[model samples]
Target: MELQTITIKREDYVSIVEINHPPANTLSSQTITELREAFQILKDDIDTHAIIVTGAGRFFVAGADIKEFTEAFGDYDAAFAMAEAGQALCDEIEQMKKPVIAAINGAALGGGLELSMACHLRLAAEDAVLGLPELNLGLIPAFGGTQRLRKLVDMPTALEMILSSKQVKGKEAAEIGLVQAAVKGDELMDTALTLANSLVAGKSMTSVKRALECVVQGADEALEHGLERERVKFAELFLTDDAKEGITAFVEKRKPDFKHQ
Candidate 1:
């Protein structure tokens, strides 16, 4: 697809998706649609083993386009649709088989933070700022932020951040487990790429796919149910060719050459 709001670049097995919306890189309707399309394509691409998302300019996505909010104002249906759209996109990202990493080079506020939260992993620049500042604009996070924030941080901290419209620097974000790590601005992309590559380095795509499913689909369920799911998947993997090769290679004391079958 011809992307107008984002750019996609391939680096061996990793696809770097950069939001190019100028200034603050706010998420407009077009930007959201384009992102959804881009990810959909990447999801099925065999050449891509992982994905990294970042922003072009100084902002990693400041927020949703405030101007678009005006169009949905006073229309309950319109506003509800908008929220659903954003939530759906985030859910897709969260459930993808291949891991997605957010390289937060600058500010990640409102929808931006929500987007990063959707990723399986996140790396931010030390100077990067992240938060859900919708309350400052007489609004609240509508794109799964209310649910995801509490999962990352405690209820009290999430409540305080949202209610007070607080923004945290990347270091504090890491301390609170909001992001995995924080590095220098110049090292953000390299760190993200390294993390992404490490996830798929010597693994079979079949195993990778099932592991992601086990975690994403099972995390929200009861312990018994999650265990049962994991057990079933573990048994099923034994039937795959990759599993046989991996087991035999262990016996031979050599690296297993995975065909990603």
Candidate 2:
């Protein structure tokens, strides 16, 4: 499919998706729609075992397009609809079955940070900076940032960052658990692809989906409920051919060939 706001390229088992809006890579409503469409195609592609989301030029995503924001949010209902759409997009990313990694190459501010937070994993260039600076615009992050950031870090740190509109560099973000790792700017995509390749190497897509579901969904539920779901998934996977092969291979002392059955 042709997409104006983003570009997609396939490499090995990974879909390299780059947010392609020029210098800033702002997320206008149309950009969000394109993102949803792009992901839909990626999700349906059987060969796409993992995905890496990055940005073109200098910014991962600067923020929402203020021009689009002012135009769409001319009234209360429009504002509500816009916020709902943005939040729903983030939620979709959070729940996506295929592993999605955000390679933050530069600034990931406001909605950009929200999008990165939704990914299953994040790897940042050492020079990258991330934050939710919506307060500076007299607004709060409407794309699940308040919730996801809280889940990712301590409440105190979340509050301090959000309230102060503070931005942190990649290394500090990794140290605080916001990103999985930090690499040099030139090596960011390579590092992300390496991580993606590792995940796809010997893992069943079904197992990957269920495992992600357990963590992402469980994060929103009570501890007991989450544990119950995890137990159910654990027992259920044993019935799959992949699981059986895994066990047989372990017993035989050979590498398992998983067909994602």
Candidates' TM-scores? Answer: 0.98, 0.96
Candidate 2 lDDT over 162-238, as tens digits, reads: 99999999999999999999999999988999999998878888798899889889987999999999999999999
Q: Quick one: best TM-score, which candidate? A: 1
Tens digit of per-residue lDDT, candidate 1, span 72-96: 8799999998898899889999999
User: Global lDDT for candidate 2?
Assistant: 0.92
Tell me how far candidate 2 lies from the true structure as C-alpha RMSD in angstroms.
1.3
Candidate that would win on lDDT = 1
Q: What is the alpha-carbon lDDT for the whole of candidate 1?
A: 0.94
TM match of model 2 to true structure:
0.96
